[model samples]
Target chain A: MSILINKDTRVICQGITGKVGMFHTKGCLEYGTQMVGGVTPGKGGTTVEGLPVFDTVAEAVEQTGCDATMIFVPPAFTADAILEAVDAGLKTVIAITEGVPALDMVYVYEVVKRTGVNLVGPNCPGVITPEECKIGIMPGYIHKKGPVGVMSRSGTLTYEAVWQLSNLGLGQSTCVGLGGDPIVGTSFIDLFKMYQADDDTEAILMMGEIGGTAEEEAAAFVKQHVTKPVAAFIAGRTAPPGKRMGHAGAIISGGKGTATEKVAALEDAGIEVANGPADMGAALQRAMKRGR
Target chain B: MKVHEYQAKQILRDAGVAVPEGIVAKTPADAAAAFDKLGGSIAVVKAQIHAGGRGKGTLKEHPDQRGVQLVRSREEAEQVAARLIGNTLVTIQTGPEGKVVNQVLVEAGCNIARELYLGIVLDRSAAKPVVMASSEGGVEIEKVAEETPELIFKEHFTPDRGLDDFQVRKLCSKLNLAGASVSSAMRFMKGLCRVYSELDCSMAEINPLVVTADGELMALDAKISFDDNAIFRHPQLKELRDRTEEDPYELRAGDAGLSYVKLEGNIGCLVNGAGLAMSTMDLIKLHGGEPANFLDVGGGANVQQVTEAFRILLDDKNVKAVLVNIFGGIMRCTTIANALLEAYKSVGFNVPLVVRLEGTEVEQGRKIIADSDVDIITAEGLTDAAKKVVAAATGATA
Candidate 1:
């Protein structure tokens, strides 16, 4: 009943020969993900971790019938790898590589839309359906299969929220990292729809940051459409204006994208807002009670 | 990845966009020579900094002196440049501490018949590059958007197609441009759009897109910022970065592949992930303590980056305590623990330190810290970490 991915979803790794790619591929495999094969351009016809390697995504798909892909290509070539996966009819493409050019993402966003493909991230930890499957760099032990669905714009922060929830005896249906970049493949609204439709997901937890109106837009959408209880924690409240706090996309610029404004928007939409990082679990508890 | 006005004008001019000719001068003598070379009776000397609102900004030492001033003679240009260069400028954008103006741009004055506002930015909601124009110029665009929203006309264009001719024409008509000015506006706007896309600009703004007496459209002021993620493709744009305009600690952190921003607080925070770093700052503030800086060691941060991050955090004189919060994902908790031990031995932490490690290999990481002889306070959770760090920073018993 988990959204986006589960045990039956066979996946391939792009750029699986690289150090980071290989390390996380093994991590995903150890998490019991259906790691079928890998693609490394020139390094085809090889074997790694007892899995076959192919030259292109198409070949990998043909040989293994993989329906999903985890991309670990470098930033410069991440867009091409994503397009290759989409062109090969991979239903779900997850890009874990960071620093992909904004223009490249802009073009990729349009193509992904035209082709009806679900793209997860270019600077994110990827996705996980608790014990069923894991397709990202997030720590696998912190998650437990349950009713809550989590989505966030950060990696470690997502882990923080999940840890709090799991410690509070609330396991997750799925956790999706939407990435920290200014331009990404997925948005909060897109994931909200899936979480609302998933039978296993009784509640939703959203983690957002300063910069951009995505949270505000998501708040508006949730108010109009979502029936599931939702709680959110927006970071960067203590951030000064015009200063980029770590993330490239996280900044208050031209009097816009302030945390104050985002918090006000989320609260106005009837979503429970966490007071701080430690309050995420409590806020979700309050949201679920209110939904009942 | 923001370029100075002079640098932005140079980039725009090279991209076939019409901009006022300007020369960057680091000294009064260079400014005087530039004024003389321009051969104009009236020239503008502008303080070159990364912030905007420079035209209305005032010098801290000489409140009567403006950052941007019109000079009648070469000596006047030199005098204005002398007052601006090496002086702190306090603008609406720059904080009260002000930014040190290291250079001045001396440019020939423009004959402005009319002024308009033009800006190109990636519209996050629309998921496309948008060109915004307004007849109200030489003022803050935010003010216009807030006060008279309809005055701003926006046109969204895809990256591959760029700004279409019809979009430009529609904007010109909306701006009340007619006759030869319409065609000039078309060329100016289209060329600017081309430069915006080709250069991977995050924002390209002309506060006052001036229409001359001869019906020629020119960019009187240019403020361009390229996408930092896209800067790798444009090697030439990388050279345009002004290190003097940035904080030394932040620059050092960037060199070490850490994302850091210096803030005016006492508690230094070193954490993983941007969101977690910011949330750590918020928690510190919530616990009645202020964070000195925001430093994200980043996912998969190795021993070197962690050690460097510690050095940068400890280097801040305002820091009274340091907090390390790591929720390991791709980055393991043991790696952070080992790095912390390495940093404790190499950099030597003088400030009271608090560490919170969670996620993968937590026990091993905690064991590493416990086994080490370094003095450290360990917390179990995020709330405990924040309260302990705040108490430690305030010199109170926790």
Candidate 2:
């Protein structure tokens, strides 16, 4: 019933021997993510946490038959690692690594589109399907198996929303962080489509910010396609124009990509916009009740 | 990551693009010498600052002084440079405070001709680099794109594959260029595109790409910014970063591996991840408190980085209280808690402190804060943390 991954989905870790890779891989494994193997170039034939290791993604895929991969490579080599994963025919690749060059993502985005492999994030907090599996760096304790689908463009911000949703007793069917970069592998439209098709996901909660036209474009898609009830929160309402708040991509340029504009677009599409950060849960609860 | 006009022109010229001969000078004597060296009977003295609209900008100290001046003699160049070098130039782009001009660009002025706009930007929607050209130039391209959309033309280029000849030719036709000027313009645009890709530039703008009186193609002005993520690939390009033009606190924070932006408020926020930091600031403002700065310790920040972030926040005089919100993802709550105590011991914290720790090892993190001798107020959740921090800030200020 999960979108991209479940308990049975075998996973391969890229750059598994590195500090961050090892730490998060351990975390994911502890959450029962079905870790089969990992890849770390020269450190092949070594085991970090009782899993087999190989030199390249192809070798890891061949040895373990893993369909999904968790990339924890450094920012400089993340683009090449993603292309390698796609070339190896991995069905899903979730990159927890941040700061991949925007130009590199341009090429990776094209290749992934042609290959049909679902790429979640280059600067994101990977994906989680509650108690079944977790592929990102997010803490596993806050999630519970339920009906709502959560998606966001931030890491810790996503955690905050999920924590609030959990407190409100609206456990998530799945949560995905799309990453807060100028360019991302996954968009709100893509996640919305998946959520609409999944029967377990009765409602969707999106956390967006001011930056690119992705939110606007997603609003257009939701109006035309998505049938599920959707509640949204757009951050940076008070952010001054033209200043990049904290995210590299979250800047209002040429008088476009403002918070007010995004909120208006979402509202125009018949989606309910949360009044503020603390009001998201209440708004989504109302939307879910109204959907049926 | 944006470079001044003189620097942008140098990069463009290196890639074989046609640009006016220019030299950067720090003093009026240097500018006069450069004008004479360029065989100048007529030259342009331009104040070098990051913001655009310098041509129409006026000096802050002397209202009558302009940023860009056309001088016919060496003495005129010296006089203009002297007026601009030590003065502040206020432009439409630069705020009311404006930017201090430290250098002047002296170049051989071009003959009368038609001005056209040329630029390459990484279009997020297309997921590709796009080339934009318009018949209107020497003015804001944004205004033109908004007012007369059809006047601007665009061609998308794949990152793996660069711009082709036909794409450039098609763009030239859209500019209404014909004859030898068309071919020359095509070459110039293509060269600029090459520089854009090779340099890993996020934006490469040649505003007022002019066609000379004698049918020559020349780039009259250049504004370029490189992708910060891709800066590691190009070490030589890193040298072009103008530190003086940047905020000193932000620069120091960057060096310490913390993403920090100075804001005018009483509450200083230190959080993990950019999105969380922003939301934290929003929450503070919503709770009737203003955030003094936005500081993201990042996902993998260690004890040293955390200590530095604390010091930076404490250094701000307006900050009456500090809010530390950490969600243990790649980073653990216990690690951050230890760093907080260490920072307090070394740098000392005189301001009211509100700390909220969640996620992995929350019990141990809370225990560490409880055990510490330093005065700290712990919150149960985000809402509690925001309310407590706002109250502490107000209480202190009141």
Candidate 3:
């Protein structure tokens, strides 16, 4: 009962000829994700790791009947790749590429909103449905199929949380990395809604960092819409202001998007916020028990 | 990615935006020559540093020297420049260890009828670029937004199409601009918006968009930052990067395709992804330890890059212990382990090291590390790793 993907979700690869695309496509295939075909603009009619490659996304979708596409194109072409996927009528697109310009993402958001297609990340670690399907670049060994759904704005941090939860025997239903970019296609609100609707997701473990008002808005959405128990963790509590902190979106500009503000907002919504990354597993455990 | 005020003004000027006539001077003689060339009785000599509040900043060595000073004569301009150049100027933005002033902008002073703030910033909530205007111009816009939010007005604009007529009109009316000043403001804003979109700038701020007593709109001060990701599309913009403004280690790390930040701790960290790097730092602090730096080798870093990352961490003088946390996803743990051993062989492991690895081929990764002759401590989990590193760093038992 994964929110976005399962074993049956057929996936096509965008920029499947690239080095990263080749490596992760093989990984995804090994994890049991249905690799239908791939799209490389000029390198159509080729094969990568035994998967057929088409010139355009439309052709790949037509020939393979794939419903989803995972993008590993470089930054310069990522926006266009997303637009191509949306234009071709792909229902879900997961972009693992990092460093797509913020302005480009602004336009992508406008287009995706109008088309009503779900887009995961341009600088994220993709999404995983544990054991059933994995589209992102997360370690598959640690993730186990379970009732707790996890979401984060970071790549390795998501792995850390998921690993802790799995070690605690509280595996995740689906884990989504929302990308650590200033502009992202999906927010915590978007995932919270999906997790709430998914019957298998008994509790939600949300990990956020100081950045945009996405966390605040998600808190508002959870208060109004999500009835499922949710545990939250916000990183960069000890980080200084104005530093980029590795992620382009991790800066606290104009005194906004501080860790304290996000923690306060989440607590205001009756969600338990963890003290640190290590405490999140226990926090989710408490939230799940309360929900039961 | 932040360009100096003079450089930002040059960009805005090239984009047809009206900016103050100025010349960059590196020395006192150059300042005097620039003042003479401008042929103004009064000129403003401003220090060129990548920070705000320069007008109020004072030199660290000379208490009487201000970063920005008004000079009535060419000699005064030379004197101000002499006091500023080769001296550290401390501003509110720059910490106590202020940036050294290598250059100064000498410009003909303007007769200001009124001071107004104008800026174009990428608004994440709206998912668009917004033009922000406030009557309280010269002061800090952040303070104004915090104390009197209503004083500031914003108009969101699409990047491809740029500022719409309606948005420009709304901006003018909201700022109580009318008549010739209205057209002047409109032209200035349109040009600024063009610069923002065409150059792919994340933020373009004009702290004091001045209206001269003669009814002309001019950008008195400009601070612009380009999107690092989009810098490839605009190759010319990359030339504006001032390596002097950034930490040497961070700049080198960037060149090596690693994200690194030096901190005031003794425990060096190498991890994958930004979030995990930060979490590792936080955990190190939680366990009574301070992290010397934050280094993310990224998701696709190869063995060579990992070795370089190790070299970078070891380069930090304060590093007494090092922690390498890798959660292999697309990056293999075995690859990282091989790189770590190779880096140790080349750089020499002079510090206590702790490693916690998980994910693909992790068993093989652990076995390689175990088989290696490098003195390394492996942890079972993040918490245990933190404790081990902290204990090693502080000379306490694990």
Predicted structure with the largest lDDT when compared to the true one = 1
DockQ, in order, for the candidates? 0.82, 0.72, 0.75
What is the per-residue lDDT of model 3 for residues B1-398, given as tens digits with 9 covering 90 to 100? 88999999999889888998999999999999999999989999999999999989999999888888889999999999999999999999988899999999998899999899999988878889999999999999989999999999999998888887778888888887878888887789989999999889989999899988887789999999999888888999888888898778898899999998877898999998888888888889988899888788988788688778878888877788999999887788898888888888888778889999988789999999999998999998888999999989987322
How big is the positional error of residue B13 in model 3, measured in Å on the Cα after superposition?
A: 1.0
User: Candidate 1 local accuracy as lDDT?
Assistant: 0.91
Docking class of 1: high
RMSD of each: 1.5, 1.5, 1.6
TM-score of chain A of each: 0.99, 0.98, 0.97
Ranking by lDDT: 1, 3, 2
The digit string of per-residue lDDT tens for model 2 on B28-141 reads 999999999999589999999999999889998888988999999999999999999989999999888899999999999989579999999988888899999998999899
Give the distance in Å from residue B358's predicted Cα in candidate 3 to where it truly belongs.
1.2
TM-score of chain B of each: 0.96, 0.96, 0.97
Clashing pairs in 1: none
lDDT of 1 by residue, B237-297 (tens): 8899989898788889889999888888999999998999999999999889999999898
